[model samples]
Target: MSSDRTLLMRPSPAARESLSALTPILHRVVERIGETNDITTLALEPLEPPSMNFRCGQFNMLSALGVGEIAISMSSAPHERMLRHSIRDVGAVSHALCQSSVGDLVGVRGPFGSDWRVESARGDVDQRDTVVVAGGIGLAPLRGAVEELVRDTQRGGGRIFILVGAREPSQIVFRADLESWKARGAKVSLTVDLATSEWDGRVGLVTTLLADAGFDATNSRAMLCGPEVMMRFTARALIDLGMDPEGILVSLERNMQCGVGWCGHCQLGPLLLCRDGPVVPYAGLVSQLLTQRER
Candidate 1:
């Protein structure tokens, strides 16, 4: 354990090179599965795997050779060999990337930005209980974290409660995974903004579920990912429930042109969302998060 901590304190040269943003490696699409009307999950096999590893909330910039490039978060956990991305087709780059067949090559430029801090949260003896709040496709980035928590729960590491919300029942991704996590002793709650006749579950905004999530706000860590508005409101709600502002983390989305900090496209205040964040604590982010760009 001491050696591991020492290694973390001083990353090797190869590890640093693996995290370089300027280079883009060629990754082949091994499989593509549709998640919803607009979302698709793509499995990419890298030509040469990087020496460095990625955390749960980190993202990669994927480029369709002829089209364009866009940022997508990995839905798979770090221990997983294949890089999995759950992307919603909101533009040309994302659509083109998702349209690839079994053996198409694409450019992968990252594993960038901050993480959900699940390790730090779980490692803290006082903060063993975790609260995960996600909405819509925002669940993509949080999925890896949730899986880790589930594994931890099985080993008696900590208790995790997942609260997810989507537009409707059909829009919920990883439904089976949620059930599996629940069966494994993790508490999972889901809600939708609108429901069909086939649905008999809760129907409302995700924040409403917080009242019954069964987590101790004062002693727990909360990680949120979703539309900016939803994250903002959810953070506020957690604060009201006595969660420390520093204990509340939120992932932000922006126009990230370059995977590195060179591009000013994703800058918010003095921090570049591509480099300094994507995942940031709520403690000192009031001004930047409340800014117009966040909305």
Candidate 2:
């Protein structure tokens, strides 16, 4: 079997092309949707038609011209024509992105990294269950996968369950999408660490919702995106509930400068997160996830 390091070092040909080109493709922000007080979703249209189509879990390096660039995951589905990124005003570049107007031009570098591979999770049977867990803004990365999963479930595929956690009700990002997913037949549950007077749902850690989530652990695949601590505990919780560690996946974040393996900034243990993953199986990350300090 190839080691994780070896596997990560060998990126797909498309990724190699993206990494080789340092030039940014200019894209215009066609629309902006405010999700919360500090988070906004930008829909970008390339000046020319894009040459590549991004997959779920892939990230793009979005540049705010003079400000800087940041790696943001695509919140739009793979089939969409416009590239959508949900940005939070946590840093200078992100703040710039959040404040962008409908006609603003942004530089885009890639649709890089390993993907969630949601299509394969159901195998040939197409009846396997899928569970998605997102915390805070982490939902931005997993939104594409959830969208695909929802469509799959509608076509005689397995059941879909979405579990979300936020700091408060107002902190939740895809509010309307959550309602649409539930309306479309997904079993959706939400919880927050704190509650406002307007909130009437569950208030606790997202992990608590797992107990009541209905899924056959023997034939289920779980994907999680959140703070590292939250992912660590949630992955462990899923395992304790009889899910295989190998069947669980997590998306990680790091100080990524270059959106390729050439720069060593995003290394996590033996993996260069930019090339190897933002999304990876829990089985391959057990050692690193358990021992590595948060970056």
Candidate 3:
């Protein structure tokens, strides 16, 4: 394949081993908060937190010793010493990681991939609005960006609009955080794919919520994460609403065996989701890559 087709140049074997990508560092689990039957939020204290600086949408290769390793996104705000991972029990490695108890040591190998551009979203809020759209577990990667925006809003910055959707009300993650943001001046809306009789909230596709999200599309920058199909439609909706394609960002999910570009598992056209991005401008992506299976 053409070198231009890859996100970055592949490092030599020696370089790969010497880099942090292959060297696993031991981190102790400080807490494990369960979100649902299959999802757990884990907080880990690494041996050296400062050395592990990461931005939103980045991932870590977490290894449960004998079980195996998996690529999981960091769910905490930037610069936090206590790194967090919101994981779902979908496979052996994930199940093992979620089952880990407090004080247990797990191998961590990254703070990998590109960022969600929280800083840019915070800049010139008077001229533009930051719109965040997340669905189901997609909220995991978005949690940090939301926190960043919340902090900015608290500092007298502009308001943000967050739209979240889940299969049902029960599947919604970070309910408390969402409410807290809303109370602090963030425009937050919720919807569910299938609503129970008890649910008085909006019930339908997430796109339906856009009709009333009240964001200025021409002056808005959107960050999105969710099921591929959902993101596809969401991007289309955003475009139809007059947002620039370059201003719409999406985080992609892929089979990332290596948290670096060594493995081709996470390649998405001219980019590697591991290195070039898990978060990318919607304008740069091709349809085939975005529709592939989730991580």
Candidate 4:
């Protein structure tokens, strides 16, 4: 990563030990929320006291017994007691997880990978702005960071701007949280690729909103999560506006079969996303992002 970027947090000793073991800690699903037609949020309670401590942008390996396991981002804030994962039913494992009922046992391992390190965005002066860009279900991974940013802004730290884009108004996840964040003073903007008759929001690529967004490009930090194509374009747009590439971060997704680095399934260029990233500075990924074919 770039010298200007914050170092990725290493897993704690307890997390490291947990990674060495393959067995998952079983948790019971306490609540299931339908965020959209395809996306669902599962709130889990540990069978024992919670020992896993995760930062924003970290992910957990969730297993649906007799099916398979998949990587899901933590959609709830770290300060929250229950563990929440927003899953999109894209495959067998995810579908099984989404179909899980209350009181069902789900296997969970790891609060792994790198983190968003939102605190670093506030430099010595602590007045730097935070710009968050999300596309489709990408908002799920960024929820924790957004919650922290909102609280910081409430404490009179700095400004926060959230720019989100989805396929349509109906596909927007965390609809209630978006309203609450806006009401709590974060500058929130919504856009869609397609619109309905009742829709009144902007209709265009999320990058288009950057021009009118009130933030200091030179001093602000940006965090983006979305499809590879969307993130590529958004990162480039931020660079064109004078933000340092090191100040821009992106969350990547891959076929992460193993939460540890032992498996090479999730390699992206020189980094193993399962261990080295999920969150990484854009400066280090520029070449790879430009050349690698999207999966």
Candidate 2: where is the Cα deviation over 4 Å?
A: 1-21, 121-125
TM-score per model over all chains: 0.89, 0.90, 0.88, 0.90
Q: Name the 10 consecutive residues with the lowest summed lDDT in model 4.
A: 1-10
**lDDT scores of the candidates, listed in order:** 0.82, 0.85, 0.83, 0.85
Candidate 3 — which pairs collide? none
- Where model 3 places Cα greater than 4 Å from the true spot, the runs are 1-19, 48-51, 121-127, 291-295
When sorted by lDDT, best at the front, the candidate numbers are 4, 2, 3, 1
Q: What is the lDDT of residue 90 in candidate 1?
A: 79
- List, in order, the clash count of every candidate structure: 0, 0, 0, 0
Error of 4 at 223 (Å): 0.5
Residue 236 lDDT (model 1): 87
lDDT (tens digit, per residue) of candidate 4 on 91-175: 8999999999999888788888999886754443246799999999999999999998888786666898999999999999998
State the TM-score for model 3.
Answer: 0.88
Tell me the lDDT of model 4 at 4: 30
Runs off by more than 4 Å, candidate 4: 1-21, 121-126
Q: List the residue pairs that clash in candidate 2.
A: none
Candidate 1 structure quality by residue, lDDT tens digits, 1-295: 1545334333344754654475556667899988888898989986555533789899998888768888899898887767899989878998888788888877777889999876664464333688999999988999998888777666666688899999999999988788988998888999999999999999999999999889888888888999888888898899999999888888888898886888699987777999988989887655255446643
List, residue by residue over 201-267, the lDDT tens digit for candidate 3. 9988888888788988988889999988899999989999999989888988888888779878987
Prediction 4 global C-alpha lDDT? 0.85
